[model samples]
Target: MSPEMTRKIFLYGAGGHAKVILELLEVNERRCAGIYDEYGAATQLLGYPVSGNLNDDYKAADSAMIIAVGNNAVRRKLARKLSANWATVIHPSANISSRCTIGNGTVVMAGVSVNSEVRIGDHVIINTNCSVDHDCVLANYVHISPNVALAGNVQVGEGTHVGIGATIIQGIKIGKWATIGAGSVIIRDVPDYAVVVGNPGRILRMNEPEDVAGK
Candidate 1:
């Protein structure tokens, strides 16, 4: 097997997102040692054994891991609990420009298109079928949900969650810990911790500081 294919990696989720990530790993020919989930009841996932609880010591220091949880807050919490080397999983079907920089622990899902000079931060999730245009900057722990479209030069701050089918206009800046509701079309700058919705993307509410404290 090729060197890249021979690398063993562990996954820290067993839900739908994990299943998709597992498929990505398989298609890339990387070996998945097992899956870990704190709440898992089943003994297996997608034919791979569900090894044990998420907190259990696996003792595979050489192996890397990816946080496959879809919830941005939960994923961020889980990321801090582990000190293992993180793995970046990119689906082969995704078209990513060579000029783009993806940080460690990021996952680029199937059918996603990331254009040139985009800077994606650590532990970020660029979910299925999303299109990120050139020069977009996504901060750490950000989650761009499925079918989201980010126009060129858009800046998404840390821990922000861009909901599914949301579209941001070019040069818009979404603030930290904000939430863009599903199907919203952003045409203006969003303030920190704001929850925005609707076609033109109006602010519905501001997420309190206490709500985003730990995450």
Candidate 2:
């Protein structure tokens, strides 16, 4: 591994998302000095010590960090608090076009494809097997779940969760904190905090508890 690959760092979460990031750290040959989670009292993750607080010591020990929280809002909030340099994590197997601009603290998981002119904002999660086509703009803290397909020029707002197998048509705009239900086909613009579901994705609720998978 190159020296860059072995750079020391801390993780800012200890949930399921953090576990996946741990695997990535190992693959890149990076050393994880510790993990900090306000909710995690556990001592270790994959044998790395878990530090409870986001201390000055932890922040000063490393120059890089990955926000491994699944909830986009929480991740963004903590990221601002840490204020460390954001590290983008792209799996080696992912195919991202040269024209794509991925902002810091983003993770492009395996089998994901980001086409030309795609602008991915900070702390976003583009999970496995997702396809983001040309001219798409994903704002900060957006989570595109596995098997989701975003057609061209789709604008996803901040902290939105596009659930598994969701299909967003071209030129559609999804608003901030909106929940796109699993297997829904969104053919139109969705308003902020709307929970839309079903074929063609009609608005089911507004400003509701996000877990549209249960709806």
Candidate 3:
């Protein structure tokens, strides 16, 4: 059996999103060795150890990690580089249909509801209270922010972020690395690297290369 079965999970960030993920671990009664941040941003988080380097608390074969950052692009970058095994955290309160498929390292936060035929890719985040309807396809590293509502057959591409309180109607397609701003109502398709905002979801700007996918 894999040594990772010992109940310890390692987090790869130290930030507000990390805090929320840490609590999810707590709620599930999982033990965390510490938080690993190469930048040395923090030394402690909610009483858990924060290490500048990935510590030797667990053996490499036993280390199960979850990218705790909120940024979709950064999460994708880290997922590609991090050699550790992954963990997917779904809050106990989340109502995810068994018919849906959630890839490794994904997180379904509290109060979230995912309907049947939904395909959520690796390291995606369905944030608190979000409603993902039937047949939605969420590509890798996508972040569906808190309170966002995705109607049936909606497709969100890689590293796309649907901001808090945003609503996308049925059959909408949002492209890679796109940003749908908070409270926006998406009525049409969004292209890659597009920054969309407002009630009618107008294109505000395009993201630079550094902030986009494959960066």
Find the candidate with the highest lDDT and give its number: 3
User: Which parts of model 3 have CA positions greater than 4 angstroms off?
Assistant: 1-6, 55-59
Q: Model 2 lDDT vs. the true structure?
A: 0.85
Writing each residue's lDDT as its tens digit, candidate 2 over 44-136 gives 887778878677644453457888889876786777777676677788778999999998888888899999999999989999899999999
Tens-digit per-residue lDDT, 122-207, candidate 1: 99999999999999999989999999999999999988999999999999999999999999999999999999999899999999
Give per-residue lDDT, candidate 1, residue 105.
89
lDDT of 3 by residue, 1-215 (tens): 44434657899899999999999988987778778888857889998878887655543665678899988878888888877678888999999999999999998899999999999999999999999999999999999999999999999998998999999999999999999999999999999999999989999999985857767
Give the Å shift of residue 76 in candidate 2: 1.9
Best by TM-score: 3
- Model 2 Cα RMSD, 1 decimal: 3.5
TM-score per candidate: 0.92, 0.90, 0.94
Q: 142, model 3: CA deviation in Å?
A: 0.5
Identify the superior model by lDDT, candidate 1 or candidate 2: 1
Question: What are the C-alpha RMSDs, in order, of all predicted structures?
Answer: 1.9, 3.5, 2.0
Q: Where in model 2 is the C-alpha error above 4 Å?
A: 1-6, 208-215
